[model samples]
Target: MFDFLRDPQWLWWLGAALALGAIEMLTLDFMFLMLAAGALVAMVAAALGLNLTGQFVLFCLSALVLLFFVRPVLRRRLEESTPLAVTNAAALTGRDALVAEPVTELAGTVKLHGEIWSARPQWDGETFAVGERVRIARIDGATARIERLPA
Candidate 1:
């Protein structure tokens, strides 16, 4: 492994790029893609006969440039992408969730989108029966604050 670092082949840099990209699939955060681009640039530098130190420096510069300058522009462009049809929990304002079990005045749980989540009625003191429909008020950490839906 360390020997490959000394050799600094283009394939090694390309492999690093691919590995970073693969990890991004699980994380879904946009940070890794920048590093991947950097690795690709380093690979090209290595192909051009640059030494390992030069390749590493090129990679660091590429990553820094992408993160500081390119990332914000790309993020802005992607922000206007077509909205997902399904409402993610983070986007769950005014959405409805079914109560899978009775909600006591303090706390309870509900089923939404095939997932069980801790829930609480919006008002200071309230209780809800099972099978009732509730409107999502807001989410606090892992808990969903909700209220009984209007008939």
Candidate 2:
């Protein structure tokens, strides 16, 4: 095995390509995969009896092309295919809540989506009586801004 590698320099290039491909699997960033593709191109050049310098040049050119062109397209496609997830305070907007206490502009309490939350009226001087329904307009720090629901 050692003697065969000495006779065929292309074997070294192929081994390097395989190593890079394995690293690509761990990273999942596509950068190592592009480098692996370049190494494979270098392996082809070595098999065709190109000098070491020529093989190096082929590898560099191939890697650059894949990094600049192919990588961006692949990244964009992956991003576009992924679904957007709503989380945290953004998830509470426009939801319904029940006034757990007399909700006034100053301070109050409500049950929002089964969770007790600090709340305040959406408008100045507005208030909600206990057991009234309200809509969550937005979240402000630890408080929910609420508007009274239509009768």
Candidate 3:
């Protein structure tokens, strides 16, 4: 009726694995999950009547193997599955910009996304007056290539 009281090491290991797994849900770092896997290996060893030392050895070995070998592959697979997010200059394309200084064929300045930037007209003959609204064609190095807004 009280067999667990005589031999409870496996139950202790199972408890540890469950605790680590619960921590994994909060952290999402995968470290606790790997440790949980190790604890489970130790739990299995205990259930098979292995001594404490053997169970510990299995836990350490399995944890190291899973952390080093499996973790990288899992991280890489997740990153590969997700598409890259557009940022910085790439994200600025097609967005609106306000001409801060008179823009001409050669050079000018514009306020884009709250930051002042060097700008140029998309066409050589075009020009933008101060405070004129424009559309960003693309980013050229540190400069913004701008076009006129529709009337």
71, model 1: CA deviation in Å? 1.1
Candidate lDDT values, in order: 0.85, 0.90, 0.92
Provide the global lDDT of candidate 1 against the true structure: 0.85
Candidates ranked, most accurate by TM-score first: 2, 3, 1
lDDT, residue 95, candidate 3: 94
Q: In model 2, which runs have C-alpha deviations exceeding 4 angstroms?
A: 1-11, 25-27, 47-49, 149-151
The number of residue pairs in model 1 that clash at the backbone is 0
Tell me the TM-score of each prediction against the true structure.
Answer: 0.52, 0.75, 0.64
Greater-lDDT candidate between 1 and 2: 2
The model with the greater lDDT, 2 or 3, is 3
Residue 132 deviation, candidate 1, in Å? 20
- Clashing residue pairs, backbone N/CA/C < 3 A, model 2: none
Best by TM-score: 2
- State the weakest 10-residue window (summed lDDT) of model 2: 1-10
RMSD of each: 8.4, 3.5, 4.2
- Candidate 1 lDDT over residue span 5-78, tens digit each: 56659889999999999997887666899999999999988877798999999999999999989888887778
> How do the residues 34-135 of candidate 3 rate in per-residue lDDT, one tens digit apiece?
999999999988887889999999999999999999988888898899899999899999999999999987879999989999999987799999999999
Best by lDDT: 3
